[model samples]
Target: MPIFGGSSDSEDERTIHHTPKLFTRQQSIHSLFGGGKFADILLWREPKIASTLVIGVSLLWFLMEVVEYNFITLVCHASMTSMLLFFIWSTASDFLNWERPIIPEVVLDESSFKHLARSFHARFNQILSKLLDIACGRDPPLFFLTTISLYILSIIGTCFNFVNLLFIGFVSLLTLPVMYELYEDDVDTVAGKLMRKMRKLYRKVDSNVLSKIPRGTVKSKKHT
Candidate 1:
């Protein structure tokens, strides 16, 4: 069975649409991640599956972080445990004249893999293109925001390594979305107020500092 379940909606239909808001612009939290089965999982629309996912992640964190098991060690231990059980079952069934256990065949589907590869390729390229645009000064606000975000991440990286950071992010994904969805109105109101304050600050800075800077005029070149 697939770990992450599939959605009924096609890939194109997975992209969600949202009304424009003062703070979020063209997207809300639900729509930002793409609204479908995946969004439902993130938002806890299916509480049982969401809870299972949370529990599983918590167990993995405990095993890796707390128990300090390396990836290879953990995989080996799990495989040994599984094989031992299967061995016991097979022997016991033969002795007891019981039906033999049937092991399910696991196969990788080519088409599904190709589809996933294509999706990843497209998304990766899109992100690279957008980052290039921001770097080239095509979007000043986005460029600044990206710079600040990376700086914050770098600071955070000093405290937690990549694995710990990934764990934290995974836990947050299983939490923050549902919480925001439950309290959407209140959260949006607070966000709007915060954005207004930010805008006011920006305007003050523009007038007091940026506007005072001298600008050189661009001269038109005459064609020879």
Candidate 2:
């Protein structure tokens, strides 16, 4: 049996002796900061390995909060450092008589350019059509269509506020998945208990409140 992922004694020993914190911070840090070869190995071998990007991004944003650094300054610094490194690498390459190409050549002739343009145009139109379909409720009920309309309006409102946009990104991309990954068992346990309690409460509410409340007629669109 294989030592990496097999149901053998060697695999168990490897897990215990080599990397005890396989799902913890040490593993994540190694995966991120490890060189191109390390990353390539992970990609090639365990292509479908679970990523903790949400938690990673959340921690990054937290660090950003503590440091209180200017975004523009950080961007400028990164740009300058990248350019300087490129020049230094080129100089070293020449001095050491290294002949390997660092940057790959992109042969963007007229024909290729036209193809690229067409691809972009097609994608744009496809996305536009999809958005229109969602907005118009191509197959969904009017209630769901209204929900979609409100969601789009909410997004438009959020676009005006940078903080709101940042929070949305944090919740949607970073916090949600990471939180789910880290506390999945706990979350499920809590959810199960909560659902049981909710079922009881729902039954009570249905008997006591809902039965007494008069139902109102839902206004429907008249057929043209």
Candidate 3:
């Protein structure tokens, strides 16, 4: 299924006349990676980065296995301790003129503050509405499939390591959007043809077996 759900009127077009019919390898790589034609594809591909990151971290796990090193606990303690001390180090001279303060200065006037708050509230509502649509509505062709896929992923999350899930999602995020964008125009015709074939197959199946099946599921219960 295409990663991004929710379709528009423009998506129904058989062909994107502006897009070139022929696709080259470099163009494909560049589209996904955001690189020059000559740039190394491995540098931009998320799977490669995620895999390498895991392999590198596996060395620490290997150390723990062989040498009885407390690398995992040490990492947690060291990171938290370092961050705490580092923040204290920011307690310095001048009018709180620390070079890298975590918080930004609040310089807004009352009107500007109200405007910013209103803007954020409006944006949040828009996002919430879109999320509701994606969760419940099947207006988009991929909506039901995407929803089921995510539900399955959540169910399986407990079986895998956090890093594994992170990498999986990281790769999906990096590749899916660009791949769909680059090939969407070409895919329309293929999707249409495939749908036609599927409909034909379904008609035969329906006539033979599905039509005879009871419609018990379709019946709604009334609240007393």
Candidate 4:
């Protein structure tokens, strides 16, 4: 019996039997790992660390500002400031790494990758809607506003004293995660949706072109 429009029962059975189960399992594993598994881990972990660093540095800066002039205080403040600056730089670098492109070729094919990408895109869109609500001053986190305020304060404090340096550094460190959250949340906006659709179309076209080229030709051209 022919199923769908093409293969007979015997042909279908042979195809099914010949297909490697290992390949299917490997594909599933690759998809799970490649589709933002590490990214999610980093995104979740970095923010908490950044937030803690920001709070600690901000408190130290506040203490330095309140106390009178003293060598010990100055030394402590400077050390804290240095550590805070290091954290800020590290966090920024990590953010850059997070933004690095995940090439689609590694994990997806023309037949199934498009569907996976679309699902992620839809989830991202939902995240974006939530982010917009936060940004609009409706049930927004106090910590978010406080973080921004402290960052501005730290910048201004820099003009008057070195203590503010620590504050600025910490706040800057915190900002990276905040920005990421904002971006992650907005993945479903009109522009984001449009971009995803365009990319999907391009991928489909590219896959079609590749599919038409004979496999033997591709191998020969590569060898030559």
By lDDT, the candidates rank as 1, 3, 2, 4
Kindly list the per-residue Cα lDDT of model 3 for residues 72-188, writing each as its tens digit.
776887689988876676766234775755655878589866765776687588656656765664333334445667789889898766655665665565555556656766664
How big is the positional error of residue 114 in model 3, measured in Å on the Cα after superposition? 12
Look at candidate 1 and tell me the lDDT of residue 6: 22
List clashing residue pairs in candidate 4.
125-188, 127-185, 128-185, 128-186
The local distance difference test score of model 3 is 0.53
Provide the lowest-lDDT 10-residue window in model 4.
Answer: 1-10
Runs of candidate 1 exceeding 4 Å displacement: 1-32, 97-99, 114-146
Kindly report the root-mean-square deviation of model 1 from the true structure over all alpha carbons.
9.5
lDDT of candidate 2 vs native?
Answer: 0.51
The alpha-carbon deviation from the true structure for residue 20 of candidate 4, after best TM-score superposition, in angstroms, is: 39
lDDT of candidate 3 at residue 218, scale 0 to 100: 78
Q: Top model by TM-score, which number?
A: 1
Write candidate 2's Cα lDDT for 1-224 as tens digits. Answer: 11122223454445444443322233443244232433433333323332344455455565455565566775687689988888887888888986634687977689866766776687588657656764674423322434666799797876656544674565564334445556655654554443334445645766898789999999998999
Question: Of the pair 2 and 4, which is ahead by lDDT?
Answer: 2
Give per-residue CA lDDT, model 1, range 1-224, as digits (tens). Answer: 11011212342133222212433245667675556567889988889999999898888888999999998999899999999999999999989988888998999889877876776687688678768876996434445556888999899989997778988899898888788778876666564444344445655776899899999999999999
Candidate 4 wrongly placed segments (more than 4 Å): 1-48, 69-160, 184-224
